[model samples]
Structure formats: C-alpha cells, structure tokens
Target: MTAQLEATQVASTQLDKNTIRRRIAWRVAQEMNDGDIVNLGIGLPTLVANEVDKDVELLLQAENGLLGIDSLALEQQIDLDLVNAGGQHIIAIEGACYFNSADSFAIIRGGHVDATVLGALQVDKYGNLANWIIPGKMVPGMGGAMDLVVGAKRVIVAMEHTVKGKPKLLQKCTLPLTATGQVDLIITEIGVFNITQQGMELTELAPEFSIEEVQMATEADLIISPHLITMPTPH
Candidate 1:
C-alpha cells in the first residue's frame, strides 16, 4: 500500500478505537441513577466519569477512601493528593468525604455502594470475570475488585470487544477469575450484553457493525435480545 493509504488506515483504526471507547463509556453512564453511589474501577471504567450527565446525582467512590469524586478537565490544575483508585487526579464534589481504607472497605463490603463499573480481561457467557491476572504477564494485584463486585448492588463491566484482535467475550475465561458469575452488564465497542439467569444476551449493537460481525467476534454463543437496538454513538 502507498504511504498515503497506510496513513489513512492508521487514522481510521485510531478513530474506530476512540469511538468504541466513547460509546462504551456513554452506555455505562446511562446506567447510573440519581443519588446512586458508584465506584469506578481503573482503566476504561474511569472514562464513564466523563460521560455521566452533569444533572445526575451520582456519588463517585474511590477505593482509596474518597467519595463524591468530580473529575477535572484537561485545563484544570490537579491536586497531587486528590486521586482516584487509578491514581488519576480528580476534584471532590460538594458533600464529599474522606476516611481510612478500613471505612472505605466497610462502605464497599457492607453493601452501601449502589453500583461499580469495572474493566475485565475476559468475561464468559456465564458472567464470570477474569480481570486481575493475565497468566505470565505481570499486573498489579487485584485491589478492592473482589470486595466491590460482591458488595455493589450492580456490577457493570466496560471494556473493548476484543484485545489485540482476540475476543475478550468468551465461552469460558482462560484467565484467573476475579469474581465468578457476578457481572450484571457488559458494554463493549460492538455491543452491550445483559447477563441474566439464562445467559449473556446481546441487547444492543453498534450502528456500524452487524449482528453477524458481533457474533463472529464473540467466542461464546449470544442470545439475541428481542428488543435489540443500535447503540448510541458520540456525535
């Protein structure tokens, strides 16, 4: 291919990736309810903070003992001490409070948190999550994920449809499990899956992708939702 064509392909790929991430974040944000206390895990899940509607009364929780997080914009000066679980600088909203890790874990493990958005390495059809370890690959140990997953009323996963062209949505998670059968919902670049007693249901799809494409990319069988619809994309 010509240099111009190669450049175009690279730009297109980047744009696609960005669009996918934004869509996943937006969908996860829509799941938030007014006055809900939510914890957002590191990585892709953190992006949901930006997509949340300003009017929504969500109290963002950080595992490191901060609550009611208000993410700062690019131009804002970040306070070194005010960081989320991902260690990204953030601002505290009105009524925000802080405590020690003991209190934080109490809030999480005691089931006070309404919801938690997390990113996963692999999620099986049975809603099993394997996010902490990737076999031989070195990774930060699973922090409060296990506690949060079991404690939160709702567990939503936000991640890419695939990793390095390999499917992350699988028949069975090959990686070590973080929390077994705990995922309530999953938002990926190509679609949304709702985990029910029956199994993973494909409830929504990206406009640019087809059901066949999604099925092909997914390793597990997907139950098509009767009310399947196109996913909302960024304008």
Candidate 2:
C-alpha cells in the first residue's frame, strides 16, 4: 500500500474513544419506543443506558431488582446496596424501585421486557449465542442471560468485533452454547450486523470502512444486507 493510502486509513480509524460503543448503544436505543421497558445485560450492554437520549422515557429494568433508572457515573467511593447485575457500583434514579430476584426472572421469562441488549462471546450465522462461558471453565455461571434472551421481544447484542483479536462471530460456535439462535442483532466496532436465516447480514458499516474491511476483521463469512447503510456520525 502507498504511504498516502496508509495515512488516510490511519486517520479514518482515529475516531472518538467511545464512539463505536456509543454508536451501537444509540442505534439500539433507536429501536426502542417510548415507555418500552428494557433489560440491559452485563458489560457493554449496561453502558447503553448512558448513551440513550435523556428525553426518551426508556424505562431501565435490571434482573437483580432495580427498574426505571438511568446510568450513573462511577465515583471514588462505592455504594454496596446500589449495584448492577454485574455487581458494579451504581447510583439510583429518583423513581427506581427493587424486587426479588425470582420476581425479576419472572418478568423476563414472562416477556415483560420489550427489549434486551446483551454482550456475547460468540454469535453464529443463524443467530446462535455463546456468551456465558469460555470453554472448559465453568466458574462464572449463567445469571439471567438465558431468561432474557428467550423472553425479550427483541434481543440486541453489543460487543467488540473480536475477542483477543479473534473473531467471535463465526459460521459455527465452538464455545459452550448460551442460547440457540436467539440473537436478533450484533453490533461491533466496525459495523452493525443482523442474524438472518441465510447468515449474519451487515446492516450498517463504519465510516470509511468498507464491507470488505469488516469481513477481513472477522473469521466468519459476513454477508452484507442488500439494504446496508453507513452508520451515522455522532454530533
């Protein structure tokens, strides 16, 4: 490659540190409607709460009991009582309330959640997910992932393009399965993909990044949607 092309490529990738994650969150939020109750999975999924528009009355629900809240910036000190499903310290919004874990599961299992955003370890062409384990290791148990994936009306997954620089979205999952073909969407740093019957279809691509570039970033054979669009730039 010529030095000029290299420079252009480098400059294009020089996006805001949290731009990709926030973009994923923003897009996911766009799928939600007013008064829609949401359940955010641990990790990147939880961060979605912070990226939503303030005016959007998107109610936030937690499997660990809290509901109708927003994300709070972490402070030096922590509050043991107020935490996320991941057990991270958090602050409660004004009208936030809590309930029993069993009741929370019931809400999820009963399809009370309008939408759920979750992080995944692997997602196949057919939308199968493997987010609960790392093969041969069972230390971290599957919390409410199973319930949320199957119960929610829509399941959106937020994750990096790869793990340890390896593609997690594959033609077939090798990791212990979390839920079989339950994902509706997969948002990565490079693009937004949707799981279809044929394969993982690219719905949106990052700025200046082509569908070919995104395909190169993954080991999976990513198929671009016929109506693929470019992700909107942040203001």
Candidate 3:
C-alpha cells in the first residue's frame, strides 16, 4: 500500500498494526447488533466506545456502575461523577443509568449482557483465559473478569499479539486464570483466532502478517481458517 493510502486507512477505520489492539476492540463493538447489551472490561476493552456507531442503540455497561455510557471527548468537559470501571472519565447518554458496583456485577453475573470484551494476559489453545495477577509478580486483581467471562453470552478478548515481545497466546498460561474455557474469540495485532473445543483456529491475520509468521509467533499449533480472508484496509 502507498504511504498516502496507509495513512487514509489509519485515519478512517483506524486499521493498522500500531492500532491493532484498538482495531480488535473496534471489531468487537461492530459485532454487536442493535439493542445488544454489552460489557467492556478495563484497559483495551475501553477503546470499543470510539469505534461504535453513535446511533446503534447498543447499551454500554461498566462494572463500576454505569449503563448506556457515552465516550469521553475532549470537546466536552469532564464529569467527575461519571467514570468507567477503570476510573477513567466517561460520558452518559440521555437514557443512561447508574447503579452500585455490586449491583453492576450482579447484572453481569445474571447474564444480562449479550456479550463482553476483555483484555487477556494469556489464552491457552483450549480457550482458557488468564488475566489476573501473575503469582510472585506485580499484577492487578481480576476485578469483574470472572463474572463477565462466564456470564456473558459470548466473550471476546482484545489484546496485543505479544506481551514484552513474547506471544500471549500459548499452549498454556503461566499466570493464574481469570476464567476457565470461557473465551470465544481472540483478536490480536497478529490475527483473529477462534477458540473452539477442537483448537485455536486462525480466522484472520493482519494485512501485513502471514500465517507462518503468526504460527512462529505463538507456541501453540494454529488452524488456519478455511475461508481465510485478509482484513480490509481502511479508506
């Protein structure tokens, strides 16, 4: 691709290796149908708000106590009382509502959300997700991950292809798990993989990355999509 087209793609759909993490979150948001109730975990999952259509009727649920939340914009001043689970500033739409954090988790545990997007630290070939504190190492708590993973109708993981330059997807996770066999799909900078009972199937790879390249990156065996297609470059 020409430099100009590359720049256009980055500006339009925000698709590129540098933004791959965000693109995964964006793709997860795009998967939502009208009226779908969705939960977004902290970190990369928070970026989904920027990619969704403003009029799609999708309700955003935050573990901290907000629903139907809107994206924070620089054009608008910050609202101290409105924040997401990560404690980041967020805006609320006209029909948005707030509840207690415990109640918010209850909503998730009750399977009220159609889907959830979360960041993963490590995902095994069997769909097991590990995102909590790595024992003996500095790490954050699981927060609401356990509830969301098992309760959501579907769980999508948005994360980088690697952590500290090592592949995050592997045959097994080295850290304590957030949830067991709950992840449905993983979208990463290298590719999109579907975790099924059989194995990790590669559905799509980043435009500049090849299947061999992705396989070399991960420790687990990869199953390429029979209907594999390259990602569309942004206009």
Candidate 4:
C-alpha cells in the first residue's frame, strides 16, 4: 500500500477502536437513573462520564475525594488539585463536593453509591471480575475497586470483548479476582451481557457483528436472550 493509504488505514483503525469504546460508555451511561450516585472506575469506565447526559442528575464520585466529575478539562483549564482517581484532570459540575479519602471510602463502603461502572480484565460465566492484576506483570495495586464492587448497589463492567484478539469472557477468570460474583451487567464493543442466576446471557449485539462472531470470541457458553437486539449507535 502507498504511504498515504497506510496512514489512512491506521487512522481509520484508531477511529474504529474509539467508536467501540464510546459505544460501551454510552450504553453504560444509559443504565444510570436520575439522582443516582455513580462511581466511574479508571480506564474505560472513565469514558462513561463523557457519554453521560448532562440532564441526568448523577453524583459522580471519585475515590480521590471529588464528588461531581463533569467533562474533561482542556490543558489550560485544568486544575492540578482537581483530578480523579485515575489522575486525569476533570471539570467539576455545580454542587460538587470534596472530602478526604476516608470520607470517600465511607460513602462507597456504606452502600451509599447507587451504581458503579468498572473496566475488567476478565469476566467469567459466573460474573466474577478480575481487573486488578495480571500475574507476574507489574501493576498498580488494587485501590478502591474492591470496595466499589462490593459496596455499590449495582455493578456494570465496561470493557472490550477481547484483549489483543483473545477472549476476555471466559468460563472462569484466569487472573486474580477483583470481586467474585459481583458483576450485574457487562457492556462490550460487540454486545451486552447480563449476568443472571443461570449464567451470562447475551442480550444485545453491535450492528456490524454477528451472533456467531460474538460466540466465537467468547470462551464461555453464552445464553442468548429471546429478546436480543442490536445496540444503537451513539449519537
């Protein structure tokens, strides 16, 4: 391929990946109810904040002590002290509050958070989450994920369906568990899965992908929902 064509392909590939991430974020944002106190975990979960409707009255909590995360701040507009748990600079909305880590943990551990969106390294058929570490690889220690998953009334995992073309949805998680049997729902680039008493149920699929594709990529046995539908593209 010509250099120009190669460059265009690279850009297109990056855009596709970003579109998938935004789609997952948008779907996760829709799960939030009005007046819900939601926590956005680091990485992909943080993208949900950008997709959230401004009219939705969500109290966005950051474990590092901010309580009302808005949109991403521009370089010149960023406040060094106003960063989220992931250390990303953010804009705070009106009625935002700040407290120490103790108070933040208090809110999370007390079950005051209505819902939490987290990114998972792997999710099993049983809905177990493994996000904190990869065995033998250097990783930042598990910070507040354990507390959020356990304390939030609802837990939604937003992640890619696969990592480097390998399935992330498996019969059992090979990595260390961040929280066991805690995930309620999972939103990925290709589909949505609901963790039910029976097992992981595929409820929605991206328009571009086929059920067979999803099945082939998922290592776990996926129960197809009778009402399975194609997920709408984000506006």
Candidate 5:
C-alpha cells in the first residue's frame, strides 16, 4: 500500500460505535457451528446473519415464526408479508416455514434451538443477564429474551464492551434480570469471554486492545485463559 492510501485509511477509521458493533457481529457469526439451529435477537445480533460462513449450514429462526432465514432482504427484494422477530425485512430460503407464535415458542421452549444470540444491557460474573427493561423508563415490554435465554441450549451475548464507557459486564447486574446463570459466551469489540463454572474467562483479546484495557472496561472478575488468542479485526 502507498503512504497516501495508508494515510487515507487511517483518516477514514469508523466511528467507535459502528466499528464495535460490526466487529461484534462478525465475531459472533464465526461462533456458529454447522447444523446448529440458531435464534438471533434484534439489533446487532441480526447483523450476524450476513457474516455467517457461506459454507456453514445452519438454520436461522426468528421468534416471529420465520425459519430457514437466508439473509436480510435488500429493499428491492422485500416481501410485504415477511419479516424477522425484530420486524426487519428478511429473505427466507427454499425450505423456510412459518407458524403461529405458539409453534414458534414451542420450538424454542422445547429445547430444539441449539443457540440464541442476544444483546444485553448487562452480564455478570455468574452468567446472569439483564437486558429487558430499565428503571423509570417507558419501553417495549421485554420480548422473548427470558424464554430464549432459558430455553435455548446455548445463550450467547453479542454486545459492545461497555455502554457509553460504563461497564456493562458487571460483578452483578443492576437492572432487571432476563435470566440467571444462562449465558455461555460473550463477544464484544474488545474480547471474547466464556462463562464457566469457575467464572467469566477472557479467552481472546482484540488485536488493538491490551489485557489491562479489557479489565478496566469490565466490572466482572476475569479469569484469563491459558491459551489466549488475538482476535482479528473484520475487514
């Protein structure tokens, strides 16, 4: 690369919010295993779909009853009647199926969902999650988060390292609980963590951040992994 082009790239660095979110989504996409039946929560988690490995065969299900989701539909290809759990337009693959809310929840609550990716307001050392509601604020009622966390075989929290510089990974959640002792893993712009019987483990660090920086951004105690890896930035 020429010096001028390198300078242009540096000057065009994405705003932190966009950078972190895209990084989290891309990292989460890599965590999916072939043949897994995955449920994606709204917002950042939905972004994971487009980043999934093309060769990986996994079904994406939305709580709103659509399954075998192919991708988020382009504006031109959108069907008026189809959408994901977040009400965002999406494309359903050939074998896609739709059902009533009853059957949808049945698929999740029946323990058929292999994994669920969700965003959280807070995650604690004990694998507890709080993402539903904040005190003294009017908001949409907690959707299916509680059920998803409880019912899915694996719960993954895909969120930024912090909320506007405030640590969202805490020693204990300060907000209303979505589920307790449920989250299996967390992916953020700064690192990847796993909730283990011993506690939260920092298994990987982003190439741009130091271990000290990660700890400073987290309120939960971290058990550093023996085989820590550097997380590559998404192109």
Candidate 6:
C-alpha cells in the first residue's frame, strides 16, 4: 500500500506483450504437476505450453476434441487437420486420441481434467471470473470455459497485469461471469495471486517490481502474504 516498498509502481507502458505473456506462461507452467491432465484455454493461456518444465510430463487436451497434444507444430510439421481449441496447428503426442465434442465435454464434465489455464478479462477478490465477453463488442463466444472451471480439479488464470493502464483485477468483475468462486490461482506479468475466502493474496511477484507496483496496477485490495516470494522470469 505504500510506495516505499523497494521498486516503483508498474506503469502500463513499461510492459511488452511478448515478455509479459511469456513470463505469465512460465509462472503458470511451474504450477502443473507431473502426469497431470491439463487444458490451456485460447489466446494467452496457450502460451503456457512453451514453458512447462522438461522433467515434468503433462497430458494436453484441446476442447476441440483432441488429447495428448504434444506442442504447437513447427512450420514443416503442420498438419492441416490438427489444431488445439484455439485453432492453431499442433502435434499430438504418441497415443493421443481424438473424439467429438460429446466425448471431449465428457472428459471435462466427468472431472478427468486435473487443471485448466485460462485468460480472464476480470477477476475479483471473491474468485469470480469474467472473460467471455465485453459489453457491446463482438467477442469470442464462450466455448468450454464454464465447463472447465466447474469440472477441472484446479483452475488457473493466465493474463496481463493491466490493459492500457486500466486494472483488470478488480474489487468485482464488471463483465459477464464465467463462473463463481472457482479460480484457484492467477498469474500475471507482475504478480501471482491466490483467490481465497478472505480475498486475493499476493504470493509472488516479479523480482523487478515491488509490492507497491502490484497494488497500483490492481484495483482490488491485496492481502500481503506472510511469505511472499520474488519470481524471476527467463529472458
């Protein structure tokens, strides 16, 4: 809450898209467990695949009806028929299986998913999420977000700290709700937060920024953790 923490408050202009996205991805990947069944939502969430630890293996599922996703295909490896929920070319790892939406939703609804990473437009202190649409703008229609949040054992949100200097993490979500009290963790370029019964708690922050910087970017009141850690991003 005070500006004397150590570093200056984060300015929206100080962040770049690629750096912020990758840093968010790196932090989120560290949360996945070995052999976990995971779903990475479209857009920013998909970048998480590039950051998973090499020693930890995970099963990737695309809501578009594919499982065992290996990685985003290289230019030469592209298969016209294969893509993730985001519609990007991907390679299916060996033993990967494909099915229709019914089977895919069944996997999600059946509680087979271990964790799901998604991007949010707004997330509040109560763990409420709203990312599907923005008021009057034509938005990407809600796909499997509602099901994943309700079905996955854990739900993590990957996103930027702010949008053009506007706070996205707020006292309450201004957009349509995706689900209520379902988010477990949220990773942004500036800090990592845990949605709790008390409110949002700052667990970790980028080493370059101070707690003051994070507080300025976020609209909701942040509960400073007793054991906060500094998270350094890979260059």
Residue-pair clashes per prediction, in order, are 0, 1, 0, 0, 0, 0
What would you estimate as the lDDT of candidate 1?
A: 0.85
Query: Which residues of candidate 5, in runs, are more than 4 Å off?
Result: 1-15
Write candidate 2's Cα lDDT for 1-235 as tens digits. Answer: 2432443344336655487667667777666688999998888777778777778888899888888767854786467678888887776778788898888888899999999999988888888899898867756799889899999999899887765446677888998888998899888767788888888888888786766567766666888778888876456
RMSD to true structure for each model, in Å: 4.4, 3.9, 5.7, 5.1, 6.1, 2.8
Query: What tens digits encode model 1's per-residue C-alpha lDDT throughout 124-177?
Result: 989899989978888779999999999999999999877656678888999899
lDDT of each: 0.85, 0.78, 0.79, 0.87, 0.87, 0.87
TM-score of 6: 0.94
* Model 6, span 54-121: residue lDDT tens: 78899999998988888788999999999998889988888999999899999999999999999999
Cα error, residue 167 of model 1, in Å, equals 0.5
Cα lDDT tens digits, model 3, 105-206, are 888888899999988889999899998887788656678888899999999998877654467888988788887899999887657889977899998767
- Model 3 clash count equals 0
**How do the residues 18-87 of candidate 4 rate in per-residue lDDT, one tens digit apiece?**
7878888999988988999999999889988888887888889999998988977789989988899999
Q: Which 10 successive residues of model 2 have the least lDDT summed?
A: 1-10
TM-score for each of the candidates:
0.92, 0.87, 0.88, 0.92, 0.92, 0.94
Off by over 4 Å in 3: 1-18
Model 1 poorest 10 in a row by lDDT: 1-10
Clashing pairs in 5: none
The weakest ten consecutive residues by lDDT in model 3 span 1-10
